[model samples]
Target: MIVTYITNANDECNTRDSRPPKQGLSACGLIGHQLFFHQVVFCAALPDNTRMQVSSKVITGFKNVLLVDYLAARFPYFSAKKWAALVTNGRLTHNGQTATLATRVRQGDTIIYHMPDPEPPADWVVPIVYEDKWLLGVNKPAGLRVHSQGKFIAENLIYYLRYQHQPPFPDVNLVNRLDIHTSGVVVLAKDKQVLRQLSADFAAGQVTKTYLAVVHGQPAPPSGVIELPLARVPGTKTARQQVVGAGEGKTAVTHYQLLETLGADYALLQLHPQTGRTHQLRVHLAAIGHPIVGDGLYQLNDEDYLHWLRNGRSPQQMPLIQRQALHCAATQFTHPVSGHPCQLEASLADDMTQLIDKLSGN
Candidate 1:
């Protein structure tokens, strides 16, 4: 089990500066901060060795600060009290030595931690869409996370495929990721070479992705391109992306074609994202007059959204659909090994289909 940490702190949007940096734009554009997996720790037990995977990070920006404080600041998933407890229990170390609560850390210091294994959720299902010797594709359900993060480790798709699925695929690696609420076809590589090739293909804009979305209103133009640069909204409690001036944010482009109109209130759209910015589809749709149906985060005010989250994400809060009505309909790419064209697809999720049916009064 190998643990990797993303140490690019400038990608964060929490700072007062609203302008994105000139370089190092990751795959997700300005919203890379929300993709922070610095603190997430996953430990897999080997059959013979039972070796523990330790997550480590090298400090770069800060001067002499208490170790507990640094952990709390860098990894907001855990509180200071929890970090202190971990320090006391010897789960954390700095510079190859056990760290104490009062240990002061400085620049170039390395912090390592041994986290506990995760317990996956029992009631979950992921349907395989396509499978070959080199690759695997699955129709990921809405509300199912693609990767482990924070407290939700084993319940994610990768963990399930590695440990729970029959004829386990312990070495499978994700080629792309989708939001938890977005149901879609997710591609996974069976080996490292395939993973690298597929990942590079995605990063280089060589992959063509198609999506289906149910939005609140019909766009004026039946088909058009949304050429909007996106930047992270700073000074907000939660991470959010917004359209910025032409040269201010990272370039994000999405082409959308209206498919069907559901009465006068809603419409179905087919989307082709030219760039894979975080929440690009949803943000572009919302930037126009049409926000995706059941998108509580984008449609609702911050206060209301927080209230809904606090209330356990009840379905009552969103009546149109349970989750965002976005589905990754298809993906087209070249097979890394065979050098053949590959196109994989997933049907719309049940909830979105049911909502469409109801809107059509069928």
Candidate 2:
């Protein structure tokens, strides 16, 4: 225990400025007085590996706080790159006593942060579609996650499915994932046999996947195949994909056949991806200057959109609805168990159908 000068109760404190604490009325000096106060305790740096476990007694008003929490609450980006240098050199106050971060925090002391920090919320849930002893397929919704996360990680599709139901089958392995922004079909395997079989099948092109997309503009011709090679963009860990030379990137071929034209700005098209490159459909569409509507990562400029909107065009003409106007509608594969050809199809989900009708007035 260390000697401390406690701050008098009824004082509102803010760490807006990192200044020294001024002397204040003492709790010990007043006899027979049971007023609440801020206690300051600083411990010397003892060990490198031992983490400073922080648990505090309830002090009602001032509350419990750590040095990191204190500073992070003030300067959000409290790091060398953002504002760490200034904050690192700052001090805190105990009662009227200003103290450095090295000052130990006792029962009722407050730690001040110059910058406030809030953790960005990362959340998602994915829904499973098909699973057998060997194979599992998921109708991954847009914004659903496949794996664990910080607070919201366990709530993702895979976690939700596994947690909600304790199925007889063991750990279900996801062989693939659709982009969190792309709502579509995903496949999983429960066991190594099924995984190997499905992996082999997918590699051998035994799986035929078909998708429906609403593009930004009406495709010019009757219909055509977009066989552009694709390349994953650098720097971005994910979500940025483009077309590039064969040796430079993977050969991503998409055959886009026009399903119907809503107007001058939007067209409903069926997409057949011959190659399983990442973001194949979106990249192919964007490469043709007909990026999907609401593709935030790409298509920021509305010049093409504005030109058409100025001409009394909305997705009504092109029928580019909200979100990613793309959906995995069907998949075809031969059943490993029966050795018979099987096809699975999902009707347009409510969101897709609703958006389609809402925009096209269908």
Candidate 3:
């Protein structure tokens, strides 16, 4: 069976080293098994002289910009200097021709940006919560992206799932996504039809996503529904959302119940969002002056957020619980294939558990 891999432009250069070196038949089988699960496979007898070239489609959002400008924006992990160098070296191309820094990319143009390979994180594992032929639910760790993005390709959960579990199908799509810094139960569909059905379930509000969060300050009424419209903050590159007027933004509703009062300044709460909006839970919580602990982006001022992005965390600027103190504790939906109810749960990650224990003096 032929499988397709969407890889960066540097894949061609690394084709020779794509698989582990051969040894005994048993060893080769083990390597092949590992690669199969990850949806990356090499020919049983790869010709020594063969090299495969790979390039990704240019997404529509980046059209009508200079090659250099669009590349910088699309792949923010690459430094301006690196982009300049790549442009100068004529490593980037458009439509099978060498492109310059000033090249204007139109819609549907294929760009070969020849990005450098980033090192994958060391020894990462995604614990399975529930798995069957049609779907998978995993306890996604904080700091692991659901899919490939800017600086994370091989390090993301989808890659790990493909390589480690080697599910029968090549296409595994995320039914839901959590922030890279938020750990929780993430659902994956084994194929396209299941993906479409699950997506419809989410859109029709048939799925329930419950989250656990620790926030600074006690909320009034302790438990209540927060009805707020959310929109992207005006004139900002950062993808930060804010509560807006009813007519101005998408409707977002969060029902929060305070579970425990950790101290005078902190509280543990359970959140159930009725509408799925970008950063809806975080923006709603922060708008009420109870930002999730360790959420540097939503909790801090804009300048502080930019500073945190550039310089990392600071003792004086960041709060306890380094990442956002939020976890998708549970998710509930009907099984798309089994025609039965399904509910999956993930325990609070060790970091959040430890933080809670410390705050509660447990």
lDDT of 3 by residue, 1-362 (tens): 11222244344333334565433211111222221122233323223233322244566576578877876766656677777788788766788788887788876787665434334333676788998888989999998877765444456676667654544234466789999899999999986799999999998889999999999999999999999998998987688898888798888889999999996789999999998998888999999999999999887778888888688677577757668999999999999988999999998899999988888888
Q: Candidate 2, residues 135-222: lDDT per residue as tens digits? A: 7676777656555432232334555444343342334555555665567787766666776787788777778988988777887775
RMSD per model, one decimal: 9.5, 16.2, 7.9
Looking at candidate 3, what is the lDDT of residue 20? 56
Query: Candidates' lDDT values, in order?
Result: 0.77, 0.55, 0.74
Q: Pick the candidate with the highest TM-score.
A: 1
- TM agreement with the true structure for every prediction: 0.78, 0.58, 0.77
Evaluate model 1: give its TM-score. 0.78
lDDT of 2: 0.55
Candidate 1 scores a C-alpha RMSD against the true structure in Å of: 9.5
The best-first sequence of candidates by TM-score reads: 1, 3, 2
